[model samples]
Target: MQDYSEKVQVIHNEKFGRHLVAQLDIEAGDTLVEERPLLVAPHWECGQMKCAKCLQESYVMCRSCKMFPLCMDCQGHDDFECQFFASGGPGGYICKDLLVKNYGVCALMKFLLLLEDPSTRKDCERLLETPINLDDYRDGDGMWQEHEELAVRPLMASGLLMSLTQAQSLTADDLHAYCIRIDSYSFEVTARDGDTLKGVFVCGSLPHHCVPNTVVALDEEFNLKLYAAVDLKSGEVIYNSYTNPLMGTSQRQHQLRLTRRLECSCSRCLDPTECGTNMSSVKCRECPDGYALCELSSGGDWRCSKCSAILPAADVHELLAELGGALVEAKGELQAFESLLAQYKTLLHPNHFLMLDIKQNIASILRATALMNCMDQPSKKLLARRVELCSELLPICRAVVPGISKLYAIALFEYLLSLIELVELQFSEGELNKKEYATHLKTGRLVAKEAMDLLRFEPENSSEGYLVERLAMELERIESDIAKYGR
Candidate 1:
């Protein structure tokens, strides 16, 4: 494995409960480092046998799809439950690699390299065919602890392990000694057998800042690395692009409630400072000669902060038009589309027609980012949320747009993926309902059909559009199976 000087440290701070910091001044386009695999497990019918989530009896489910095993008894326990809301069905892919052999942290770091990205081309073009694990290699729990004494397996097994220096720099300890996050940042690729990696897409690497110092993109080396778009002094916290550190208590609280698991009381979160400008909402059109409009107060009449005059609600329509046009054109603004959303609130209520339009744009960006980032391969909550978002948007899409828009189509397609997850979840929970499973499978097929139609115009819908397009074939296959076997 390539060795470079990387930094890791643990520290304590009030802003972040318990934090970790890593100081590696990655040259302009250098790839961010990878992490040491905490543990390695056997894959398939090798030495060990169990599910990734439930740790129950695991068997090779499918050699082609590479997913979960069908379990009528334990659907709720697996990590990536099928997306269907129904209980049990053979329609979902089963788990084959419980221990993630032949894959490890290298794969994790590689997948995470894509984050907050927009295009699916960047994702699909990459070669990620999995490897087979050697039967002779099997390590028990002590194997993970052996990392301190052994160099990671051949670079060929995975790739360069992430520098441990980075991990130490980014964390701190309390009296209890358990690692609480100084900031939420860490890679999620667990080590599989042969020291291979399973579960790509690193998570928990960024500390929070109001304005991010870095943007998400793949590095020149084809590894996912954090970049410093702007300069920063030592001791300043690093951050990712998509958030408003400055907002009101209620607003920040709500977002945190949904995204992060904490309720924030940070300075920028509660009180408006910086430029004495309102952030929680868009400025109203009361009176600012040159300043843009936004929500002036937490509540009440709308007006501009720069000039204290009142903005009439009627003119908001014009502002909405401007906001929509700018939002559509901002090719490089994936992380800060909120800036685009600000103008619309001046005219419409939180859920007004124009405001909904802005939300649709925001969701579209988020969906694209999620796929390129390989979110489903990692975070459980993110996968579930992605499933939920697609489900929520479907009805709205059918009613609002005549046919599904590109985003809507992608959302629908993603929802079908979600149904598969639902099946996985239900099956793992041991509550698989064949009837419900069939229902969800059917629903997913319908939605997949709609999304395929939309892809004609909006190809940027999801990362797996082509995979979803192939759903029709899978559906026909499933129908034939049902007819032949009488399931």
Candidate 2:
């Protein structure tokens, strides 16, 4: 295996399914993981019909069974007969097409064919030892649609035919064919317990579990980390978290049943309980009664556990979205995504479904800036949307929006200004005592400090680093005045 410690890495472990354990221990605000995508699959092609031979569902047309495609490599496979074409043609597995199309036939198949001949399987095996950026065939677009699967027969026949009264000698075309027919498989290796190095375990190697102890969450490094969500004994199996942490019982149960194929009978799923609902409203004495429990609630939203009263817009969705970005980009698409510029042009429009999505977004961008798209000088509508959304997304907005983006920076400024104004009014109205006024001013100072955090130094003066600094100093001055006059 390739040693990647030079790039990025962290300690991780796996254990047998003897006793169950929690995935990881996390503080209320501690970050558990971070990851970067080695390869990504496009979202649009994931669910599409894929060629069984190659796994490509896009671009390349399968040759023999023209219906299912191998893109280009296997496009030549048609010279020979094969299944997976289409109805009334050849037919095979649909999903494998994308995988086959891009990577070509399995690397192992090619390696074996090379060894069989005086060709080189050693070279192939050497390549296999390292991590290669290969697209997945399981999802349609995961693999590039343009590559052709490799083949092998010709190379083996090459030397034999040359000695005889062969009309033709083995050529590049024949060897290429041999390369495509090779079959390959995938496996993963990790320490069985915290410290023992076991070999690799193949796919579906372990039996399925409803709720296993070892929780698998991807750390920021994009590698899966097995955590002890709860403590475990020496002999235990590690499991991964299957759904969102804050998701309610019914939703969680439904997800497990639908995706993991297990009926979750966990205590939380069985109990008609609501989590975090009444916690918000009960704080302000808004809802005296505790929030109602639901075997199946629509969603937790802002409903507090202490009080069922709806919490005024806290922009929790935005908070979750920002946090979720780390994971979403890490696992990648299982298929790669379309080019960003192309995707925006294709998917986003005023009356399109995404517009509906934009409208339906529970996370108000008005409260926070976008993490990815909020950079650069966007179109009018996008800019307006940022202004509308990040106006409310005070703390997280700067993190999401680009410092150089005019609207995003302006939004931060306005957000800070509004806060400063709100607290300044506290002094004007005498509703706030001297201490209260000072505290409010301090908050304004913090907001200004956040603006500086948003500033980034680029090759040259990237953006408004000093401007934010000036604003922070201004907030400090306001705090000083509040200290003197209010007393």
Candidate 3:
């Protein structure tokens, strides 16, 4: 018998290059791998104070280098100080002038500092050897060149680099290669306390797919956890959706092309109907009952399945663009968005991104009501109606976003919360019998359990990430209610 317990193995091809394939039958929610990051430092965008040791947001600043913060747990540790001083910049006292430039510059500086260690430098050199196509870097995009000069080159020239024998003779070209590697492989790692940092997982081998079968999230320890989102057969290739799975095929392809410099040829990308969900399809102007699907080939026209009438790509583009503008206009306005959802329902498929977008907006509105202090009868009714809308969205979400994605977890959480809210509203109004209340409470518990399981690894900073605590409370409350009812 074949040994399928190896978990995953690396496979290479001319088309997809190096990617991970499952070596065993894996069920959804099963942990595939846990990888410790090679390097972790603050992102250029976040200026928040975090522990230099673990990246936790709650911390005390280092006495010498005021810029570097350390948690109480890491403080007074001789080893930590020795490592910091060896890093060079954390050697002397830091002033405001140096502190202001501590954003992306420090991350790069840390990379240079790590190179001073023989073991870490060897791993970094291995990372630099990873193949990257030059075409991914656009000449028109000055950001890459700017980062290379401001962050990369400066770090290469710093005393930190000169102190390391391995990195001492590093050239600008070598620095440019490191920059590319960082841009390509770095994952945004967020700590349990909401502190965020960017790091590269040198040991991971997962590759991108338009519709991913796996979900990756950071654990409390900042190690990357990979889970099988769907049941994986032995020898199947594992794929991670690099872009948002909620996005339509055209949008996903466009994003991958711009960012990864490659058009996806995944089954979903090749299918115009997007695996029969009709997510990218729109109402055909030529026929009432028929929907138009874009031709699979590029520059191909959208044609109605019923009437055989074709619409040019330009016309379809203009229509979607108009709907996109309307979506933006209705952003925070509930009534306007409700009307837009109805209007788009007539013009697009139920599973279209625009329709889903409005549904999500409505769900957000309902989810927020769970936190409301008071709810009158009318407010409760509105909440109930929106809850129904959220229920309708679940099947589509499950079909496309099968994994433990934020969207899937959020929808499940919102639906469960709405159920709990409705039960409470009814109980307060003397409308729910013990039997009826118990039923809803039981359903809420099950849904909450599933959602919590799905979002177990979600970062604490995300909108729905904090729901785990609330969900736990709701489930506990529901179980008590069920016990009181003798269920």
Best by the lDDT measure? 3
Candidates sorted by lDDT, best first: 3, 1, 2
- Order of candidates by TM-score, top first? 3, 1, 2
> Which residue pairs clash within candidate 3?
none
Q: Assess every candidate by TM-score.
A: 0.31, 0.31, 0.85
Give the per-residue lDDT digits (tens) of candidate 2, residues 28-72.
Answer: 212222222111122221234333233344466554454333445
Off by over 4 Å in 3: 1-5, 27-29, 56-73, 76-99, 142-146, 153-163, 169-173, 403-407, 432-434, 452-469, 483-487
Q: How big is the RMSD of model 2?
A: 17.1
Candidate 1 lDDT tens digits, 1-487:
2122244234556565433354644333233333222211222123344443333445644232244333335444322122211232223322224224422222222222221122322321221111112121223333322221221332212221122111223221110011111112222222212232222222224445434444333211222334343444455454553243323334445555443345554444434332243222344444434233333253433455566565554454456456657756866464455665564444443433344445555556555665575544434454455565556555544432232234355556656765666565654565566666566566655665666655442122223334444666656754553354335
Q: Give all candidates' CA lDDT scores.
A: 0.39, 0.35, 0.71
lDDT score of model 1? 0.39
Query: In candidate 1, where is summed lDDT lowest over 10 consecutive residues?
Result: 174-183
TM-score of 1: 0.31
Deviation in Å, model 1, residue 305 alpha carbon: 2.6
By TM-score, the better pick of 1 and 2 is: 1
